[model samples]
Target chain A: MTDALQTDPRLLVLAQGDNIAVLKATIKAGEDILIAGNEVHVGSTLGLGHKLAVVAIQGGDDVVKYGFPIGFAVADIPLGAHVHVHNLASRYTTVEIME
Target chain B: MPEMMAWPRQDGRKGIRNVVLVAYLVECAHHVCKQIARPFDESDVQVIGFSGCFPSEYGQDMMTALCTHPNVGAVQLVSLGCENFKKSQLAESVRASGRPVNVVTIQEAGGTAAAVEAGRAWVAQTRAELQNLPMVAMQPSELVIGTICGGSDATSGITGNPAAGVAFDRLVSEGATCIFEETGELIGCEHVMAERAATDALRPAIVDTVAKAARYYADMGYGSFSNGNATGGLSTIEEKSLGAYAKSGQSQICGILRPAQRPATGGLYLLDVVPDGPPKHGFPNINDNAEIIELISCGAHAVIFVTGRGSVVGSAISPVLKVCANPETFTHMSGDMDVNAGRILDGGGQLHDVGTEIYEKLVALGAGARTASEALGHVEFVLTYKSQSPSNPACYPN
Candidate 1:
């Protein structure tokens, strides 16, 4: 990956205050990525279009994206960890994931 | 200053294309209607129909609106002769609209072969005269545009939806009529959306529309959220809604509209797509094409469709411009996409830059350009049973 792709907000983050950033490409476990001018280590392999926490989020904190709260974190999420159905939940409707 | 070359209608609305429409009044007549339009394929003789044999006011109204749609120059009504679809009344409405209308009863015409031959002959005769219909020039202010997103993902909100939003904003600024809809998917952004209502009367209506959608979904045991949405990294309906809501841009909500209802004077109107009262008709919309047909029924000349996971659908009457949001999806489906809003995610330009690209493209489409879906002949259409109360008078207070 090029340094420019890592630093571009278009490729990494959508808005300034969003706690989570979407992946434009897949990343392997233990790979390092940059977020808000800081280097963060990827904890798991996540595919393209998945999201990851850009900042440390405590349990029950609002997960922000597009400068609005999409939902809240269900557990204490460390920086660069995956923020998904297991770790995040909606405040309005139940997220039913079919097995 | 973009101008559209179009066919003028008696109702004072203008159509971007003058294509003949062959309509089936019931599912039983669908085959003959399809066969009738098949011979005129690729020349804009399109087919649309209602599948329900049982009588429905909603179904009748939708068929009437679609058959008399501005894009349609003439219509052929195919009926099975005993299906209670109100074929005569539908034909009268089309005739009243000052468009050529024909009715071919399969039972009366001696069978499928006879009916198809009769319908095809009328279509051929009608298609010949469409070229001579008086043409008119329409300004951007006279154009009605619509927006919807399907097969969406995380990249949708970040790139494609917002870019379409920007284009929506630009079009609204130029005095074009613009609409965005499906209140069922906008469950979480009610309060935020209400803040932009143009009138105080419209505020509560906005909130109530979303609340109705929430209640109906709760009763049905399913939200508009889907498994594909979940796999695409959308954790909840709220996340998907927040992204979906971005397609409206930042315009003040001018009014609320029901299916077959056009905006009185459009800035940006929210189409209340969820059914009123109960969840009797199952899901408010069966799929994305249903929503597209609703928009076309509301007088949109063309629609803006954004996607992240990727969709390749275009409606029967109006052109659907596909804006691909994910760079990878765009790479895989480049031939099906009209705008590469995904480039915004690849560090090509700002979201507004793509917004500008979408705006310019809509103008080109108005000036007689074919969208990717249009060029590929994707005239997919659907109109299912649905219920909507007439618009509240206060929702459109002057």
Candidate 2:
């Protein structure tokens, strides 16, 4: 929405030390985007509020956000890949929604 | 800081709303309670009931807390004459607080019809006394603030929640007691949350309660996390927890406050909503409002409710100030929300700006400004049976 935001991170980076960045707008696969001055290609189509791998994540490694481990990657997650339940897994079992 | 008109209580806690509470001791007495409150629908007189026929330690403690909640000016108890809901004890407590309390028993009052008549008359008399109670201007330090999230969406985590977190931080720094609850929902955030504990002793309680929540939900066959939460893009319980935990901002978590336990000091507190033992009666919270009631019982003067998908519910006594996160959802449910936290996503405003607005809105609401839900008379209430020992010593008031 401003020149500062565009040149800053290209997306919403919650913390400076965080690995994942939340998408401010939807992104399509193969689009080149500027992230904190680093040019990277979008690896997948992602929806808003979805997380994108701003850094390379190896299998069995913790995925950090909010400066803490929210979950771990089940497989290799490349830069610009959408991180979700498919590749990212919660260490705890997912629960049922009663209603 | 804005000045607030406070209704002083004998215990020195004070209140923002001079609400007349009509409480039903059992399911059977619910009808009489409803009938009495219906006539006064335009008034601040509200109805809350304990729906269990059997006795429970948690239920008893909850009832006592509700009767003595800071928002209450007077209490009216309706009993079926045969339940263990503790009408006498509640009345005795309110009466001791120097507030007018009227108890009507259905069996002695000649059934529902007669009890309703007596209850209505009692409400009329109590309402006058409630209005006549003296009001004084107070500062922010005298306030106890509570926050909760319902029905999250993607925008909620990134906008509404973070905004509320900012407000929590500001409120705590200003010397107000701030509380955030739902330990069951914070399963994955145990480590991160533990890092903010104010002391070494408090860290274990925070970790253990979250573990307790995880075990209880595991046995219940489902955690508090829902499909609605998933559609919001949260992949796991921990992810949702990080969002929920954000409402605490960066304040040091003083200690764990169980249901109906008030914080002893002015600081941020985490309410452990999970029942102490294995799950009993039903889910720990029947819905979001049940959890809201628990916060009220602990003496919250007002509640900051953040909703991303849009929730219209409000509390009976303590007004619920809603902060909506989704711009589209806010557009549709603008009438229900008090603050547009979605401005952050739209880039119209930042988190601190919205948080500052929430803090100011809280002060205005304390000055007798009605919230959207309160103006619409959306008084949603629920209380269920559960067993638990009293809160651990760390949680008691200073």
Candidate 3:
């Protein structure tokens, strides 16, 4: 990570209870980030406005954001891994209507 | 504070702008209505329509509410003569409001061109009548304010909506009636909002409305069912909701209102946009402007529209104050945006500052400032079918 990353904010932490942080810019794999006094390596291509796992999430665990539950992780999401639909599923299920 | 002047209506309501509206009763009359409004070449002359031919209770209610909108000084209804839009009901309500209304049926008026010419003369005459009505000074207690977030992105949660929330706080504190809607977008926020309810009875309705919004979205999902989750910011409904809920500020939700229903008095109110009974079989809001139109129907003189992805929509009667949440998007679409709440993310300012900016912009708008969309001639209005539950006293216990 460059020294510029220390002075400038690249990731946003919305709430203290949120378990994820959003990237302000697109991040490439192997890039280093400093957040919440911890230095972590980016594990995948994290797109802008996309969520990053700030903490470990076991399978079926809730993915917390903005101090509330956004969804559940479908897989064991490692810290620094990309958090998206591939690993997360909506907590609310769709209701089917008969024609 | 500068004293704001506004168009005075018969029902003790004030309008931020004096707009002569040409309403198309159905899709067929839309073009003729547009032509009728074209020659005026003025922002105050606007066209709005309900595209559906089959009459809907909610649609009729919206048309009546819109015709009686405080900003609308007069109305010209363009009817195809075959559709069941109930022009008589609309005309009666508009006339009762003491506003001059002209109904031109294409079948009776020879054709489209003849109807347009007739509408033009009626519009000119109505303009003269509107000039005679008294213009009064608007006070905070007399103002009806509304806020909505559109095309929200990641930055919206921390910046745009929260700033709007702060502005809402100031408005509510100033004794101005404030409203925020889109219960569907507030899936995860029912509990928090209900807890802030002024009346204990309104709490359950708040929760129930959120549930209805969720069910409606769930039932109306696309075949692939990726409803804006692809936006790369929001992963689930709750995440997007948390962002949406921020727009209410910290004001106690004094009451709840159905679509097109005005508040009984001035305070913080929640507009429940979810279909009340059996589903309406159509989208709750066809677009952002539909919600804006509903706010206008509720007598909102000015609308503060916060957008992160940059929506350029503005309403016909009421002026919209566009507050951009994403700085990058603001930089890209600055021409469409009025205030840059994105400055918080760009490190130029804070949420409270953006809130103050929004509050000032709204005051200026009410004082006759032309928004970017209004200056550029973007009067995007839409109304679709939606049903509501039986009205409850709890919805408006003043």
Candidate 4:
């Protein structure tokens, strides 16, 4: 395993064999992130410590964290797009968004 | 099957760590107890205590639970001579559990200087005995973990809290014990929480506990749901409660645990934080650290702390894994937080990914890896007297 791959600036994999990667720092819209040898543009301006999809996801897809589904995507999210209330909804109950 | 690890005590119950706990019998003896624990410095000798002048059955019960907590292998009881605390009963209960226990009264032992010296010697011996004990392999099923989110904001509900819930689900499914507490914060979601209870009897108990918290806080001239919560973007208590409830991870509520009470079996349990009666006690939990201390007394091996505004406090006995939900807060307080659930809010990661990371971190901690708080030596602990009758036989089948 390459040390560069493990400490990549764009994404951090906390556990081995996990499907998702956490952003180490924010990526502005149109910023490119290299994951799995592919570079994808940042769809929305993600704040520092925010999340972006490392892989393409379809509408109604359940977003997985800690290896379990926390909620579902409200819209189709392209690779490297921000994943928050704008694109996701809690599976248990509805939440209000201010703004 | 999930693997398990345990430190076998003289008693049959398995522990994750062999700890020597120094306990202050009353608020009066706290200084001396702290002095004794200070010398051991990272030797697993944690200081925990009861801060009551007048004797209460609840105080004695909590002391007994803490002294004999699974993580604790030995105990030193520090007393100030004229207190009404039943030090004998407290010592006996711990000794009966087959753990080493010592009681030293400052007045009888020739005051502060003499007591500190004697207490230090005792701590050295306890630590010596604890160090050589075999470290057994522990499993996820053997762990009793607790979750509490303090200083919450809107991001807490959306990100860190739900991420914790995802982790809780995985642990419970693996036969690990998990507890989620703070009935006051859970006021809005009691109905939803009750629906997940293992039995119909527990459903009403769940609702009643939140109602009790509401009344208790209301009598104190402020709602238990704080104004800071609103400043952090929470509109109503229900909104906060709904978010706080996510930490339970959709597991069936197994049983209700009183402060410092261990579950008879592994699964998800709700801790009832409200006092049994009116506002005799000033506040149910004075602060976040008090809540964390109570969970430790109930035998939690560690805790998952979710926050949006950012809480830096940790417990004395159990290691706290801080999960930051607000991306901005995570940026500012990155050193203090262990997991950045806020990434989910920024669209960098999904809930399940963070949840799995937290679960794996929990396992790693159980395997003896130090958490951010543990590595930073944030061993904060507090205990105070509050009254509560035993749970109804129907609620907790002994």
Query: Which candidate's TM-score is highest?
Result: 2
Q: Output DockQ, candidate 4.
A: 0.05
Query: Candidate 1's residue-wise lDDT over A3-99, tens digit each?
Result: 4455524236667788888777678888777765568777787776688888899999999977788889999998777899999998986777998
User: Candidate 1 has which clashing residue pairs, if any?
Assistant: none
Worst 10 residues of 2 chain B by lDDT: B389-398
| CA lDDT of each prediction against the hidden true structure | 0.86, 0.83, 0.81, 0.77
* Candidate with more favorable, higher TM-score: 2 or 4: 2
- Best candidate according to lDDT: 1
**TM-score of chain A for each candidate?**
0.80, 0.74, 0.74, 0.75
Deviation in Å, model 3, residue B29 alpha carbon: 3.1
Tell me the TM-score for chain B of model 3: 0.95
* Complex DockQ, candidate 3: 0.31
Go through the candidates in order and give the clash count of each: 0, 2, 0, 31
The digit string of per-residue lDDT tens for model 4 on A1-99 reads 453463337565433443345554556777666766566766666543345566677889866543444467788977666666567665644555434
The candidate with the higher lDDT, 3 or 4, is 3
**Model 3 docking tier (incorrect/acceptable/medium/high):** acceptable
Model 4 residue B354 CA deviation in Å: 0.7
Worst 10-residue lDDT window, candidate 1 chain A? A1-10
- What tens digits encode model 1's per-residue C-alpha lDDT throughout B184-300? 889998988999999898999999999998899889997578897777777877788888898999889899988888777859999998878888888888999999999999989
TM-score for all models, in order of appearance: 0.90, 0.93, 0.86, 0.79
Best-to-worst DockQ order: 1, 2, 3, 4
Predicted candidate 2 versus true structure: per-residue lDDT over B241-264, tens digit per residue = 888888889988887888888778
List runs of model 3 lying over 4 Å from the truth.
A1-8, A13-22, A26-47, A50-99, B222-235
